[model samples]
Target: MGATVVQLTESKKQIQHTHRTFDDQTKAFRSNPMPSISERRENLKRLKRLILTNQERLIEAIDRDFSCRSKDETLIAEVMPSIQCINYTLKHLDGWMKPSKRHVSMLFQPASNQVHYQPKGVVGIIVPWNYPLYLAVGPLVASLSAGNRSMIKMSEYTPHTSALFKEIIEGSFPGDLVSVITGEADVAADFSAQPFDHLLFTGSTSVGRLVMKAAAENLTPVTLELGGKSPAIVSPDVPMEDAAQRIAFGKAFNAGQTCVAPDYVLCPSDRVQAFVDEFRTRFSEMYPSIRDNDDYTAIINERQYARLQSYLDDARAKGAKIIEINPARENLGDGTRKIPLTLILNTTPDMKVMQDEIFGPLLPVVGYTNLDEAVHYINERPRPLALYFFGYDRGQQQYVVHQTHSGGMCINDALMHVAQDDLPFGGIGDSGMGHYHGKEGFLTFSHHRAIFTKQKFNSGQFVYPPHGTSLHKMIYKLFIR
Candidate 1:
């Protein structure tokens, strides 16, 4: 009982300390509201240099957290995108910072209209376990570019990566400018509850709701990047091999732990077998041997691995055909957490795999009779963060684009839209909300203030309120119409 009391007191002290840090940062921001463009650029450059100089350490740390995360995958997915976002922001900072001129009516002729983008003080970012570096740094780049300080909350699941990230941040930046907070779920709850100018969270939908609820107390604005069952549509007109390879790449990458990874594939009923065969072949060629393959990533932990296995078990028990695509068919001992790449065919709506977002390497192939059926199948579900369509025909692409509502769409490819620096990446409805990439990211972190300047002219004195005199009548006659 005495120990419990001590722990409680310490926890309360930590919370108070965190709150004090926030208050100090807020005070600092108020003192220097608008940082110069050169200062912003230098901050970005320092951030970029930090990542570039320590890329190997970051990759190894992430690998340690994930058991075995591919270094190439980290470089391609996390590091490259972060650096690209920084570069993109630096390239366009001047134009983004400039005020835009607006047209004014003749009635307000003496005044000029313009909109100036200003920082929104301190921003809070809640980073997820998967893709921790990219998710955390992406938002930081945007916040700093917009001349605002940020405090990032790293996930407890990835401790090694989170610690390293915290160290890097603390070494490079002052606590008030850009701080890193690391703790378990309780700490995350407290972090979200704190008052911030803007809070961006990237994680599962269930937790996103709780974050939103906590933020409601402070009335803080939020930008949620949640995940859903993102579907990949394989058009009958396209080659099965082409569609299968692309979908396999999307699923196989990160062991299918990505938020925007393809959750399932919609293939024609008659070509389902062909697609499966091609997918298996492509996955085999990519990895060759799962047990000994360095390219193939292992599931993060035993809990996640067991959850994925349970998903497969539930699907199989419900009469779904499970196709395990292991080219080597090597024995994975009890200690290994790597789950073989499997495809669940003949999946029904009642199956668990179909009902939930399978954040594993398990791909569920749903057969459709026609294009409309495939599109309708996707529409019936919650709008996904990403929708992949494989086809060469422009009309079908346009048709799919017009009919579907998703955060982002990629045609003839998978997971490439996220790499584009210009596109705004986000979701709608159940998947997520608001955008944070390129200009959208800048806009998200900025509060655009409209400014109107007037000359020393007596243009408005003629229409002063005098109970509708002759001048007022003349002005009304000339301008009211």
Candidate 2:
């Protein structure tokens, strides 16, 4: 999604305008022993049970906020991932918390070294509205697993879901270790300003920068999972039909509002039409009248709907073709705004769609003369949160993986990279910074301290004498070297 850009611009004032507040309760609830590893495991179990018991509430709240979030989507993207993370972390949390051993140097005989992974005190996680519960709880599943207290700040756009999450988390954990803060963007700025030991934010690149800047005041390490113009490169070798379906599936999921959603397609000049045709057919067969349908989710609000509309309007006014791929559609109003599923024959770098992250159901198909052009296009832009390559050629896939950088990548598919717990989920460069999930998340909130134990050995005592002897010079070279 683009970002609560306007909200951030007015964060200082809008925060005051909200009338909602989160400070009066901070100090009262801030006194608690930061959970130890064992305490954290037990607390995590409690949180898991709480989520399991309240799944319905989470789903219903998200559906209400989205206007129409698919139950299956909630289960797969939100509930299932969180459940999986909890399970994965629980199974390995103990091992993850153990201090690591290191070898001692012979030069300093009898000295031992160890790296202790300690939690970085309190953590701050800022969640976006698109997937409120998931964003709110997902990072906590990791931070808590790492034995750190966390404060979750949720989006104002999804007020219903944010409130429900606050209630859910409050019931499961003490407010000190796990407090949910909900208000406007100002709350986010204010919360970010707090002296958190660590901060994890999932949102737009613009806000990610501001979050990073605010956190810099405290020099708090930040994990910013932000968005950018992610490109799905269609290699020359992959089957057009298969690649199109997978890409379409990824783009269609969440109505293309996902952060890692393939923002645009980079294909060979000849195969561009074939890719678009198949994608159009696949999308229509999967969901029809999506704008008014209960299955397809509406844009979060009027402002976002207008933003997507503006992108299309700006591009079309600049002489670009816009096509609604789906045949079934209806009147859109009263929290309904349908957008073109596909835009074809548009390759200009200056077009509005080409220039921005199309978070809605907007896809721009850019034709590259060759593979180099496609790679060049991607490399020229800021490193994306995700990169999807559709190709069977191992060399080309490997080349793209090594040559260009992204938070993550999907081979022969799209948006599935984030699904893998083994792979680190995060961004590079301006897409955002830091990584999370599983070990990455644990390491993100941990301060690994290196310890060295030196023993008092009589063998080296001769080097410590005041006399300027030859042995002292030899020992100085030997020891200093």
Candidate 2 per-residue lDDT, tens place, 113-195, comes to: 99988777777888998788778777998888877777788888998888888887878676656877777856777877777
Locate the minimum summed-lDDT window of 10 residues in model 1.
7-16
TM per prediction? 0.96, 0.91
RMSD of each: 2.0, 4.4
Residue pairs of candidate 1 with colliding backbone atoms: none
User: What lDDT, from 0 to 1, does candidate 1 have?
Assistant: 0.91
Candidate 2 TM-score to native: 0.91
* Residue-by-residue lDDT tens digits, candidate 1, 385-467: 99999988899999999999998989988889999999999989888888998889999999999998888995777767775
Q: Which stretches of candidate 2 lie over 4 Å from their true place?
A: 1-34, 333-335, 456-468, 472-481
Instruction: Write down the lDDT of every candidate, Cα atoms only.
Output: 0.91, 0.80
- Candidate that scores best on TM-score: 1
